[model samples]
Target: MDFARGTKLTIKYNGNVMEVTYISRDEDYLTVKLQNGYNITIPENKIDVLKSSEPQTVKKKRITLKHGNGTPISLITTGGTIVSAIDYETGAVHPSTDIRRIIDRYPYMEEKYTIAVREFDNILSENMQPEMWIKLAGVVKEELGKSHGVVVSHGTDTMSYTASALAFMFESLTGPVIMVGSQRSSDRPSSDSFGNMEGAMAFSSTNVGEICISMHSGTSDNSISLHRGTRTRKMHSTRRDAFRTVSGKPIAEFKNKNVDFLSEYKEKSDKISLSDKIEEAVSMVYFHPGLSGQDLEKLSEGKRAIIIMGTGLGHISQSLFPSVRKIMSMGTKVVMTTQCMAGRVNLNVYSTGRELKKIGVVSAGNMLPEVALTKAMYLLGNYPDEDFESMMNMNMRGEIMEREFLGDCY
Candidate 1:
């Protein structure tokens, strides 16, 4: 009855015999993972264990790193699902920063590329902060100096935010800086981590010099998309193709170990430089129905810059106009972005928008709310106070689109 975790078991449940992997158990129930990658909990008395075997210990073949004749690439691991594996004992996915474990999974990488490995941090992407972005920028700059390109393995949840922050921090790059993540952890059969990482490796060998996210183009594994970091957003929660480019096309696509350019991209620069300063006092608020001026004031209090994700074309409740004016008068920059998924924020289309802008709510034209937040942080951290408004409107790092096109929304 005391089966170890990962022990193979043959059990009779509901008069049917099945083989499952023992995960965990409690006083009232037993938990096991089916062959199809799903966990089920059954009443302790409802199943009869027919046989059990000890967990298998398979010796993995060690893959030694060697410099190859291909492009030099650095693999930076910052904890995420891409670097996580299931802990059978707890039935929970735990992240790992072991570069050897990762590299061992794909030994072909060592055969095709001169690979360098760095364990940046092993924290989830949600725990990422502006200070970490600055530090990451420094590490990336150092790695870029030695490698032809860099591939960052990150958690999918906040990958876009980090990618956007990096895009703004590094004005120019000598090689492609591709951030990659997987919706499914690498241990599962449906895992996209392999394809995404392979795509990142392939794209990194190219001459593209901008920060971009490499993810599945669709549910199928045939192709992967390269999205501009600032223009990308994680659209689906658990889909293989979660990240999408908003209001624009993907920069490129990778298939058959080759990268095909889909849109104009920044080629490699002569030298790399970074503006790592970031203002942590920026806050982003989503405008909701019945939100009071006091609510806005409380949220915007003591923040240097506040990004309001306003309703349709960036219109806030006219009732909150006084609070917006007060926040701006106190030297806190107020920028408006759309709550809608795809479209530019137009202040001249509606009277409420006009009123908000007249009182000094700068429009974050077509920039995603999350992107606007990072851009505000970047601008506030490095630029003078007077230059904030003008720079916000400027299309820096492709965050803003000059024209809207049909069929751009997903």
Candidate 2:
């Protein structure tokens, strides 16, 4: 009762050392906000403060509390533009672990969900790697067992790649495993961080169970679209609605503090599975005019699988056929996915494609090149005995489009 709000103190309780912000208290108990964005009420007799509030370093601190009878959602943080801020001293924007600030700016979000923040990584998404993906999978796997759902806040640069990877690594996930990001940082007035985060929390509490993305649906804050993890892509650099669902409509949309399911989704199940295995000896090459067979040869060397973002219809020049043949002869898997975003890759439709297939290259159908790469790694790591060619073309997690289309489409 003597402590005031915003008081910084070091407290030891339940065998855990935590730096907390002292909030108000009731007649019987005292409430404190933990460093990791959790609010817990404890008996007054249990309080043990090692330090008290001082004005020398006083600054704004956030206090968060769980909503009564609210759904429990794990907020896993991976460094991205969404949680980044410009370090005026360094003149560069860097990922910040101060996630409580974001929640503080949007206090209304805590009213709907009992949020628990977990820091998985604090680096830019561009720095994401296979090992990080494996670690993230393990963390998500553990969290899903205890929480109602999990929401990952990641950077937009490689957010889709991580989302696609998680879609395959975690099979038969029942609860909503949604990834959310901000196109703009929180410091700006026009930031999309608030809407995207709000939408993700809303979607996470729903019955729909799948790995998905919740982001801006349009330029305005009208709605946030929920896209299947495998079918989503960041289509623009600066737009709030940068991510678009490829070859399919968004599975659901969040608006007016509600999630409206637009398409049928995997319902929440009692079981969840995870596979952290990944073969990192895979690479991708984007085909362009005047690319050499020597380049292809070198790219395939010491690689288990190579994904080619080939030209239209998934064709490569006949000049590179010899190098491709040699690579496959050495037991390297060559998979082809088109640079074009919307259509299925057909090796039999073109002369160049037919020639490439004659040697050993396999088509990735309508899978995004990034998805193809991750799937290749996943298959090579987990199901090494299975036929990868068949698996690549199969509809696993809705990565491939059922019907092929021509021209520009979203």
Candidate 3:
């Protein structure tokens, strides 16, 4: 018998019957998640009670709210720190979720509309491949034709990549596409699972347009913030309220069961999502200190488009100029974005700016690097079939913030 992530089983511990909603397997121990959301780690040698009985069958009363359904939405889960749990045996975290578990936990959502859930992959977001993005984009296309909105449970790490990719691919959208992750795992006492899930549920079940990341905007379950997918970033590693709006502001807020908009949202057309395809080829190269041109060459090889995550206002020195020009000369579109997660890139401020602009490097404005990478993918996916440079320079969603508004922590 396979003990998967969301397996429903019962364990009789100390004469107490506890349902094992989730299992975190480690090298030498197993951590079980209880109904009330607690992880009890038991070594393989614990007293008896290892029987695999079914969980208690209890009927639940549903509490639901009204929402929209004209446009279909889907939630794709790619394994990340958010869905991960402790495997005591290995002392490593494992990401696992079952669609049934999600639905069971939030049965109240059935009242408003319906949802379709799928797991894109079970790897950390850092391990998310561009191929996964392609497959996920395809999933969105399929779901857009079926559901009203889509929510993604991703690791906070590479969520911005998927979010930006979807935002770019879904040109003009009707329903919402939300990416959600937690600062802590569902097994931890202070995990952001419940809050993040609630916020994502609110955004997806509502009549919002465009792709966004729904996460904890502040500590303590006070509110869940909906940020423009392209403009959001995880600001802290351990803080529950780690996600923040970069340069621009969040799209909206979910508090006390209410949806409060920061401003008028982009209206959705009859064609909800942009209804498009991604570019076939693109590469993302992050600029670091003492980086060599060969590094750029290796990534840009055979790539038709490149997004450079430059340091500080999008400035790269003369050392890698030859590589930048080489890629541009090969008709490989290169975009310049800031390594500073919180600011926009301005090529006009420095001599390096003139050099990059001279070599056909484009400024990505306030677009996040992940957004740029996904945008490049979406644009490059167009390939010989489409013009990437033209689309890559435009704002598909809030990915490209025309203006920057710097602010202090909320």
Candidate 4:
């Protein structure tokens, strides 16, 4: 029998009859996703494929609920694993685009906030770009005007970038713009979607006027950490608590449906503003051994800025100094940040660092490279004629940490 991709098959394997979703295979093994929600490889010769057919779709009963009186919030759904389901035909998880399943799981949300939801996009966050960032910022700004707060259901891969972009785009916010994502798909028992959504909504209802990400506080699902948008980064690939606030403290923590402030927040004013224009012609170069400036010459051709993730207090190999100087001559702004997550870029510490500064390489005080890139784009867009060297060194948001959090315990 001939079978194609997306075929549902009934097979006899090891003297037992079982049903599985046929994915693909190599020379010796067949890949299949079991009903147990895991992909496994079975020996092709050990299983007899007795039957194959297109799977039938079973419609689910939708649950409808009335709006609550607690606080008005908007749910902006961008495609992510949090709103994804197993595609049995392909044996891959894909975005469902239906957010009601997320809402139904959290019945308590109905009692606290009148939620207004919108499906903004349905693509994986890896495909996210500067255009999408601008569009999302527009949607968020528009939502914040009408709703008390907004919860953005996003994919974890690029959620930090989006959060940082939103932080720079929206200058004045009256309520929280909360971004949430999950490490596992919602169907998995270990999924962090429900807890994260709950925490995001809980924090959004508060008067915190900032852009933040709400995610699992730790490996367990007991609480969620609220990291400031510009300071957060995804540290691990598949951990529930992947995001951490780099060089700064989290603004708050949410537990048992309550937000406890970890630090002071700026007072919310009646005036709200947005600076959504972004300069996308920027590149982040990770400098390493044997890497020459010729490798980065093309990136500076039509770019407004280049952020270098340098090693050890922001020093690149001296071989790249000519390229760095050439980039400066081309009128491209150069900013240096540490590949080290916890420390500041001290170009004044070494002779090479001082020479780079003389060549107009600006140091990013303790900002993550990711945050530095977005912040550079923001500054270039909004203040093109102004001095970026001064602005880059200045602490615009909580992205720059004044001192070590734990007092050099490391």
Report the C-alpha lDDT of model 1 over 1-410, residue by residue, as the tens digit.
Answer: 56767888999999999988887788889889887778999998999999998887543222225646867888787888886766755476645534555457667666678777677876778999889999889989989998999989899999999999999999999999999999987778999998898899899999998999999999999999999999999998999998999877899999877889988888989999899999999999999999999999999888999999999899988889998888889989999999898988999988998888789889998999999999999999999999999999898898887875566566
Candidates' RMSD to native: 6.8, 12.2, 7.4, 5.3
Measure candidate 4: CA RMSD.
5.3
Ten contiguous residues minimizing lDDT sum, candidate 2: 55-64
Kindly list the per-residue Cα lDDT of model 3 for residues 171-245, writing each as its tens digit: 676577788988787777888887897788788867777778888877888899998877777777778888888
> By lDDT, who's the top model here?
1
Alpha carbon lDDT at 60, candidate 4: 31
Worst 10 residues of 3 by lDDT: 57-66
What is the clash count for each candidate, in the order shown?
A: 0, 0, 31, 0
| Residues forming the 10-long window of minimal summed lDDT in candidate 1 | 58-67
Off-target runs (Cα >4 Å) in candidate 1 are 1-64, 86-108
Per-residue lDDT of candidate 4, residues 1-410 (tens digit): 33554678899998998888887788889888776867888888899988888755434322223466768887787878775677654676655645567568876666777777666877789999998999988888888887889889899998888898888888788888899999987778998988898889888888888899999988998889998888888988988989988756678998876789988776555767888899998899998898867788976789989999999899999999889888888889999998885878898989999999899888997888999999999999889545788888787767777885763211
Q: For candidate 2, lDDT tens digit of each residue in 221-339?
A: 99999998888888999999999888778899998877898876778777887887999999999999999999998988899999999998998888888889889988899999999
CA lDDT of every candidate: 0.87, 0.82, 0.71, 0.82
TM-score of each: 0.82, 0.81, 0.74, 0.82
